[model samples]
Target chain A: MTITDELLRNNEQYAAQFSGPLPLPPSRHLAVLACMDARIDVYRALGLNEGESHVIRNAGGVVTEDGIRSLAISQRLLGTEEIILIHHTDCGMLTFTDDGFKQSIQDEVGIRPPWAAESFPDPFDDVTQSINRIMASPFIPQKGSVRGFVFDVATGKLIEVTV
Target chain B: MTITDELLRNNEQYAAQFSGPLPLPPSRHLAVLACMDARIDVYRALGLNEGESHVIRNAGGVVTEDGIRSLAISQRLLGTEEIILIHHTDCGMLTFTDDGFKQSIQDEVGIRPPWAAESFPDPFDDVTQSINRIMASPFIPQKGSVRGFVFDVATGKLIEVTV
Candidate 1:
C-alpha cells in the first residue's frame, strides 16, 4: 500500500527533529506487546521516545507461539529485560468469534485462510493469561520480567493489570 | 506520551465507519514488520483500512530473532501469509555506538539497564543483507512469502529492496 501525502509529510517532519542515535536509557529499554488496533498509539501510551523501547504488535497483542519465540530472543539477545503486554478495551479480537470470522472471509473469498486454526483466539481477555503462559514457557529468559496491562481505548488511559 | 485530541477525534470517526468485522479478501492479510518510529504510519503507508492487516513493529524494523518468531506465529496461526519488512532512512538505530548509548543513559539514569547488550546494531547500508537474513531465517514459516522495503524518511517513499 502507498502512504498518503499527509502521512509522508508528517514522517519527514518527525525524522527531522532527531539529530543523533537515541540513548537507550537504563530503566527504559523495554519491549512492549501491544494490539495492532489503529486506536492504540503505543509510544504515547508508554511515555516513550522513538528508541527507548521495542514495540511488538499483533492482532490481539496476544502472545502466541511466535510471540513466545520473539520474547525469548528479545530477552536473550536483543537487550530487552522487561516485557509489557498491552491489551485494550473494544479490541476487535474480542468482537468476533473464530468461526464467524472464518466464515466472514470465506464468504467473501473462495478459500479459507490458513491461520484460521482450530479456534479464534481472543487477545484482550487472554493477554494476561498469555503473559503468564509466556513467562512460564521454557523459551523466555529466566530472569526477564513480564507484565501485562489493559489500555482503555475510550479514555486513552493505561491501567496495569498484572506484573 | 498522550494522544492528542485531534488523533482521538479522527480515530473515533474511523471507528464509526466500520460496524462489523471487515472481510479479508484473498491475500488481504498483510503482515508488516516496521520500525517503531512515530513518524511511520503503518496504516497510511499501506493504505490500509480498519482490520486490513497485522502490523508488527520494533526498533529499526530489523527482523531480529523475535521478529521472526512473531512472523512464524502470524503466518502459522494468525492468517497472515505475506510478510513485509519496512526499514526507514535516518533511523535512530544507526546513530550511536553501543558504548555511547550506554554511557549516555547511565549518565542520566544512574543505573545500567539490564538488557544492555554489547552495542547498538546497524542495518542501514546492509538493508539487503538484513532482508536476506530474515528471508533465510528458520523461524519464518517455510510455506509463507516474505518481502522487504526501505522507506525513505526524506522522500516519504517506500522502495522495494527485496522479495
Candidate 2:
C-alpha cells in the first residue's frame, strides 16, 4: 500500500479517540523553528503538549525569508512572542553546499532551481546564525528572548547554542 | 525561568534514556508538509516512527518557494518519492487576511513585511492550492503522486483533498 493509504488507515484509529479544538493562540506564546528531520520529535523532545507552541520546520530549519515571514505572522498576528531555533546533528543539510546541491538538482532535473539549499557544515553554528537572522528581522517584534539549540539525533540530547 | 531552560531540563531527562541515531534518509521514502499547529502531533497522528518520513511544517504548511526548495533537496539529494501536504482546521492563518495581517505588523513594527501571511479562508482549498504549488514547482521530482489533506483539529480526522 502507498504511504498515504497507510497513514489514512492510521488516522482512522487516531480519529476514533478524537478530542476537539484548541484555541487559536498558543498557550505558551512560543514558536519553534526546527529542521524537518524525522528523528527529532519536537513535541516529545521538548516536553510540549497540544496547544502549547507553534513548531515551524523546514529542511535545515534555517531562518530563511519564508521562515521569518512565518515567525512574523506567528508573533504579530497569532500572539506567539518567543522564538526557538533548533537545528539537528547529522542533518542532510550538512551533506552538501548550496551550489553542490543546486548542481545535483540541475543534473537530475535539467533545470536550476531559483532557490538555495541553505546548507550548513555545522548544525550548531547554523542554529546561532538562524537565531541571529530572526533577531535581526524587522518583522519579529519580541526579540527579547531568543534561543537556539543543536539537537543530537544520536542521543536525543539538546545542547543550547549561545547566539 | 525561560522556556529554553525549561526545555533544556526536559531534554536532560530525555537524553538519559535515549538510544542511538536513526538512518539519514527516511525509511518510508515519504515527505509530508503540514501546519505547525500545536494541536496536531505530526508523528503520533500520522503513526510515523523515527526515520520513517520527513515532516515539513510552517505556519499554515503552505508550500512556499523555500518549502519547494527543501522538497527538491529532499527528493533529488535524498530518496523520498511521495509528497503529502496537510493543513488543519481552525488554523491561525484562517484568523486574518493577508492585507489585514500585513497592516497589523506595519502598524506595530513601523515597517510592512515584504512577505505575505498566506492566509486562507478554507483550509481544504488551501491544501489543494499548496499541492498545486508544489506540483507546479520544477524542482520537485516526485510531483506525480502528490496528495493534500485537511486535518480536523477537533476530531483528528483527515479529509483528503482530491487535487
Q: Compare the candidates by TM-score and give the number of the best one.
A: 2
TM-score of 2: 0.97
DockQ of candidate 1 relative to the true structure: 0.11
The CAPRI quality class of candidate 1 comes to: incorrect
lDDT of 1 by residue, A1-163 (tens): 3323333454455545535443333235456778765556565455455445666676667676546544544554446667778887766565456666555545654545455322224444476677778766655554345667776655555555643
In every candidate, how many clashes are there?
2, 0
What is the Å distance of residue A22 in model 2 from its true position?
1.6
Off by over 4 Å in 2: none
Which tens-of-lDDT digit does each residue in A49-102 have in candidate 2?
888899988999989888988888788777887888889888999888888877
Residues B45-158 of candidate 1: C-alpha lDDT, one tens digit per residue: 555544556677765675654455456445544566666678777665665555665455466546443442222354444456556876675445443456566776555566
